[model samples]
Target: MTGTLEIRGLGRNFGGLKALEDISVTLAPGEILGVIGPNGAGKTTLFNTISGVFRPSAGTVSLDGRIISRMRPDQIARLGVGRTFQSTTVFPETTVRETLERARSFLTAHSPMAWLGSFGQRAAGHSVDRVLKRIGLDGMADSEAISLAYGFQKILGIGMALVQRPRLLLMDEPAAGLNSSEKIEVTNLIRGIRDEYGIGILLVEHDMKMVMGLCDRVQVISYGRHVAIGTPEEVRTNSDVIDAYLGKDHELA
Candidate 1:
């Protein structure tokens, strides 16, 4: 599979308000694309429209050339599009292992007889183990999700998404609440996810350092309209992008 996600002339409206207008971008396998804008610029609205939280008022979204603009969220996920929200979403009472097991359930055979069979249990367990190790949570598999440090919780969120084995990951804000050290750790993890797992990532982040350092390309928006699209340096230097989003004093490097 090419694992490409393409959005064409996408737009969304809320009653009389145009939340997003004619936004378009393509994410290739293993590439990281950053989306940024000031508050109320419709970044989240765009994500919602693409991810099935809200159907678009115009245009289409496709995965590997299959039109998926009308598919439901679960249908979208089953097609290998995984996502992490802006807020933490781990089950606080569940162990790290259990959390992953729940995510693995979506891919496992769901027939009662299959679930009752030993083979199914072993398959799920194996998948969970692999994800735990990949996300650096193997040592904490038995720990309650809520008991982990905040940084670990965020990693767990990514693990939950990883268990789905997605070709494309939509990360809302991976570094939103992290300290400097935690942000660095998450940044490295994001790179590792792309380089090692070969998954395309669409990151919506406010951390300019992380965005500039990691994204292969960036699409900037303002008032729900596309303002800039280019390499990180290109967007950073664009006067319109600086004026609409990045302040005059902001540095790309």
Candidate 2:
């Protein structure tokens, strides 16, 4: 089944600080939804909440019509959800293939005795090969993950999530540290994931060009509130969105 994510009235409170409140949004299968706001706008909190890294003080997160808000992170991950951090965090000392194989263990886990008896999982190994190919690192499987160029390292982060074959991918600033051309590569990679695999994507990005060009719709937040949502053009002209990004002193031009 195509994975659809629904967040309803999501709220998170750290003591008196409300990082997110009453934030609601839905991601349909194969849709790329961009979430953008200034720093501290709670974009990371939202992603964390959805990924089960943090439990919401209120509201619920659902995937494929099942409640996942209360599930453990590994449980949520096993339920066809994947996440890439804002930073390109990978196994610095591990080869690309080994990294993926280890990540794949999250989904294809076995008893330790069984693992000892059969060290190789043919299917999981094949899956890692497919992910390496998809992320354009098939030839570099034996290279240390950290040895790749920075952009390729970011791509490896995507591969780490993709190795699980998730139906929904939560990507936090996939283009954060890339040059213009590298940004284009990430844009294409995101679009290709949606088009080719039909994975729903929830993207948090500060790069307006990538978000505007890649997302089917955009959601804007301010001070933990979901302020605006619509097509990129619609959000581009929205006054609240303008204020959120540019401040009230300036107007959208």
lDDT of 1 at 244: 96
List, residue by residue over 1-253, the lDDT tens digit for candidate 1.
6779999999999999998999989999999999999989998898888889999999999999999999988888878889974445446688989988886775555434464778878767887898898888999999888788988988988988888778899999899889989999899999999998898999999899999999999999999999999999999889999889898666556
Point out where model 2 deviates above 4 Å: 85-89, 110-120, 247-253
- In candidate 2, what are the lDDT values of residues 35-54, reduced to their tens digit? 99888999999999999999
- Looking at model 2, report the run of 10 residues with the lowest lDDT sum: 110-119
lDDT, candidate 1, at 159: 88
Count: clashes, candidate 1: 0
For all predicted structures, in order, the TM-scores are 0.93, 0.91
Question: Candidate 1: lDDT of 230?
Answer: 98
Give the TM-score (vs. native) of candidate 1: 0.93
Clashing pairs in 1: none
- Given candidate 1, what's the lDDT at residue 198? 97
lDDT (0 to 1) per candidate? 0.88, 0.86
RMSD of 1: 2.1
